[model samples]
Target: MKLWLGTGLVEEDVAGVSPLDRGFTLGDGLFETLRVKGGRVLRLDAHLARLAAGARVLGLPLPAFDFAGALRATAQANTLAEGVLRLTLTRGTGPRGVLPPAHPAPTLVITAAPLAPPAPPARLSVAEGTRRNDRSPLARVKSLNYLDNILARQEAAGRGTDDAVLLNTRDRVAETSIANLFAVLGGELVTPPVSDGVLPGVMRAAVLAEGARERSITPAELATASEIFLTSALGLRSVRSLRGRELPGFSVAEHLRTRIDGA
Candidate 1:
């Protein structure tokens, strides 16, 4: 397989990252996952805009490179007509300490993989171990620090579920470990606002544009939702159950999928 390393595309085996890279050592970096269909990248501008937003938050300067061209090249090189592409950007090598150097060279890597088969309807569990920090700036940034999400996912696995629902520090529904959460509450589709520790997912924005309202949702409210679904760069997925209680409706998810896919 081939991948795009810093400078240009290189053989995956020959590609390397320095041990001193801040992204590896301290998780100081940002990444964007994109979907490519029919050899065309979906929402390329939005993904790059989000990446640029994250870079500003981290005070990380983006390198002078054609990120879009690189993405296309990587996908084409891998012969991936339909697949997922990931662009990872990190503050290159740095010395010991949390303080980043004044001048830093960013490390960028883009890789492509064949799209996995569609997953079954998800079963979710509420994460009891950790809470999303709504007040932190990082909550809105897609940074490299994913330990919290990993923990929640592990907890869900232990419960024999597909994913975990994370509540904010104030106990309001935020999102799932890997996707934005949307539920049909009282006949209205609602997803938590970014202020509620949501990640402002690329697909989430697209769903919102479809008329889903943004508001704060409580745990109690979530349990009574008529329908629930998850949105990520990969696509929309309906929830089969939450806490072992079967959810009966996926009409909303289906409709949105049809509309979005057609668009």
Candidate 2:
């Protein structure tokens, strides 16, 4: 497969990033996973806006290039009609300490892959291992440091579930390992606020714009939810069960799916 590297496309085998790159060595980078449908990258503007936000947070200078063109080139080069695009930007190689180098050159890589088949209804468990650090600035940025999420997902797998819901330091619902959480609580669609360690997902924004409210949710409240769902760049998936309690309603997810797909 071909991938976009910095300013042009290159064969995957030949594309290289220095092992000393901070993104690989220290997880000092940002990434976006974008969906491509019918050869179009969906929500390009929103994705770029979010990327800019992350760059600002990290104080990293973005590469001076055609971001949209590069994304389109990667997808087109791969002949991707329905698939995903992952854009990774890093601070490049740095000195031997935690402090980044002055006048750093950022590395930009964009890769495309076919979309996986629709996921099955998710089975979730509350993570017991790690909690999302809502107080950390990185919590709001889609950065490369994902060990906490990885641990939670590992915990879920060990518990025989598809994913895990990560709570914040305050023990409030934050989000699932890979998606934003939404529930029909008291018959109103709601998701956790970004202040609660939520990543401010692009699809989550789309859902919120459709009138889903944002608020703090407790574990007890989550248990009483009539329907639950997850939102990510790919789309929405209804929750089959949470913590072993069966949640069998998909109407809200399906309705939102229809609306999003039509958008």
Candidate 3:
């Protein structure tokens, strides 16, 4: 696979690393997956903003890098129609002991690959794997430590499900294995509050604000919804059937999604 290592393009193996890299040894890193479409990587600013936020939380230095240049460089490196782009930042290599090194430069990698649009009306199984409460200081940060999500997704796949819905320690709906969660009830717009341990997805943030401003988010307005959806860069948004349970579709939400696209 071709990848962008900093500002240059290189074959995946060209930039070799030590087995003692902290990311492999202790999961000391973070990652962001973005979608590229129509010659533009949608929501690129939001992705970079979130990456900066995660790096801040982890005390990693930005170190004077132009990642957008790197991404564009990678896109130029290979020919791809449309694809999933991934950006990974690690704390770099370190010694055997657990104590973090005094001062370590960060490692950043970007890569892309061709991919198809995700299946529509995606059906997700309620995940058995639990989402631990907002304990980790990095709860809001996107960290490289993704074993939890990996295991949950595997559990869902094993059950022949398309995706997973995770509940928090308090049994409150938290998020899907990889996306945020929302529910419409009684004409009032309601989603599991962010404080409940949900990732602040860029789309979710836009929807919450725009949906409320235009009165398109009230659940009470839709006793019989005409659509239901979940969003991420790869899927943009996918209507849901939900683990054999049919969620009432909200015409308002669907309409808003259409408007969002047009705008």
> After superposing candidate 2, which stretches have Cα over 4 Å from the reference?
none
Off by over 4 Å in 1: none
Task: Indicate the worst ten consecutive residues by lDDT in candidate 2.
Answer: 254-263
Q: For residues 168-229, what per-residue lDDT tens digits would candidate 2 score against the true structure?
A: 99989999999999999999999999999999899999999999999999999999999999
Error of 1 at 122 (Å): 0.2
TM-score of each: 0.99, 0.99, 0.85
User: Over the stretch 160-181, how does candidate 1's per-residue lDDT look in tens digits?
Assistant: 9999999999999999999999
Q: What lDDT score is found at residue 202 in candidate 1?
A: 91
| Candidate 1 CA-lDDT value | 0.95
lDDT of 3: 0.68
- What is the per-residue lDDT of model 3 for residues 1-263, given as tens digits with 9 covering 90 to 100? 78976557789878765677787788888888877765467678888899888888888777688888777667667665477788888888898887768888677888888877456666777667657365566667788887778888898899877778776666666667787655555555555666666676777766777654222222232223344456565643554566565766646556656755313
The runs of at least 3 residues in candidate 3 whose Cα sits more than 4 Å from the true structure, single-residue gaps closed, are 212-227, 250-253, 261-263
The global C-alpha lDDT for each of the candidates, from Candidate 1 onward, is 0.95, 0.94, 0.68
